[model samples]
Target: MQPNFFIILSPAALEDLPATYMTSFFLPREEKRFLNRLLSEFPAITVIEIDAIVEQIQSIVDRVTQAVELVLALVVASGCLVLIASIQASRDARMREHALVRTLGGARSLIRGSLAAEFAVLGAFSGLVAVVGAEVTVALLQSQIFELPANAHPWLWLLGPIVGAGLILAVGLAGTRRLVSSPPILVLRGTQ
Candidate 1:
């Protein structure tokens, strides 16, 4: 006859009884201590091995990490697209204005300088908005999320808008070359 062996089970163990029982055997020292403490209060039970608990925790971590990385990639792609579109639109808009300026006796260098100045102003404004938005976003996230710490840096805020403005200026300059080279009469007539 087999010796009667007592089994200690947790609430989670009861839910997964079939699987737990399939792997049930002798308990480790830590598990035995926990079981003894549990059994002292309750009567009948089954014990879950530590290996299963460790595996479940590891699975949860892997899933969460995968989800976070997917979200991060999506955000980066969206930002890149927005920046590209903004630069393209800015270049198109400035090309027409630069053509008009050249028609009205504006020097080529002056037209370029004016566009650069406009871009600088836009960049400064965007930088200010980004800084403010970052502060507000960080504050809100810190207040709402559990176990999350505020970790905003000033350089990121400064860089984003400066880069945006520089990109816009660069694209605008590239697009205006044809307009700048055209004769004033042709520019005025909108021929090319």
Candidate 2:
């Protein structure tokens, strides 16, 4: 359909304002012929293909998503290194504490359970914080960056604590295995 507009605006009011005027055409078929005719009639008019523009936008979004994923991977790796370092730094303290516990009539099984519980609690708390951060990040990325509806990952809430606790427990137990197995006398002697 051909559309026309007759605007009567005085030039003095908007003389300094730069404006872009666009005319849209709706066609059932023969769009190429129509565009060619329109272009031939108006050579100064610029024609932009909506489909091409959309493709370019999608390509940009894909690249951005990849970049975000890479950043997330780096962040995870950094967190892992920090966790290991902190555990290593506290190794001596943990050994001494275990020795003291043994001296105070704590059984090996009791020590193991307490250690497991501590690690699990730490992991769960961290996981909760991580989940909260993740959810906020997701919400911001979706609504602000990606221009999409915010998603609340309910399943993530359920899984985060369990996964965190399991991972921390496993790592903590592995790092402290020798501390539990060794006699308190040896550990106490080393600390001296």
Candidate 3:
């Protein structure tokens, strides 16, 4: 039985309780032989090996960790795909806008700054959302599924936005580098 299911009481207070209640023990490897002897001599006595329980718990934790990692990788891959598709879909319109901006005295630095700012805001907002979602999931998993105390990870607050902004900036700049660097006249002509 889990510790959560019952409260400890004096023997006299539990006189009405059944005799079939269980007691758990922790013993060293050498002492396990003592437990085995006791179990074999008394058919009613049962001894469960802690090593087996630990191995089972570790296996479950490992499976859950792998599943979470897989989900995260899939999310990142899908986000990249969506980002690329959005950029490609807007390429023609963006080229025209870039040409117009440059034609009206806007420098390449202006376009670069505009692109960087757009990506940075998107990344930061997404990161903030991801952090919140992750913390909620963790709280649920710890308190309900694992029956453990819930704790907050402070590092997520710092790392989430930083990583998000960095990733978005790298991909966004790579995709838009040509828009910022191409000759405005050539882009205008191509658009026409």
Q: Where is model 2 more than 4 Å wrong at Cα?
A: 1-56, 145-149
For model 2, state the Cα shift of residue 184 in Å. 1.2
Expressed as tens digits, the lDDT of each residue in 1-192 for candidate 3 is 355575778999979867765777777877767876787888887667879889999999899999989999999889978898899899989989989999999988999999999999898887888999999999998999999999999999889988888888889899888878888888878853
Candidate 2 C-alpha lDDT tens digits along 1-192: 133666678989788988767766555444667878888998988987766678999999899999989997797667666777777798788888988999999999999999899989988987888899999988998999989999899999989898888877887788778878878898889953
Summarize candidate 1's per-residue lDDT along 34-136 as a digit string, tens digits.
7778767865565556677889999998999899789967964575566556656765455567777876778989976876776667656665675787687
Model 2: lDDT of residue 100: 96
Native-to-model Cα distance after best TM-score fit, residue 146 in candidate 1, in Å? 3.0
Model 3 pairs in collision: none
Model 2 weakest lDDT span, ten residues long: 23-32
lDDT of 1: 0.67
Measured by TM-score, the strongest candidate is: 3
Best by lDDT: 3
Tell me the lDDT of candidate 3.
0.87
Ranking by TM-score: 3, 2, 1
The TM-score measured for candidate 2 stands at 0.64
| Ordered list by lDDT, greatest first | 3, 2, 1
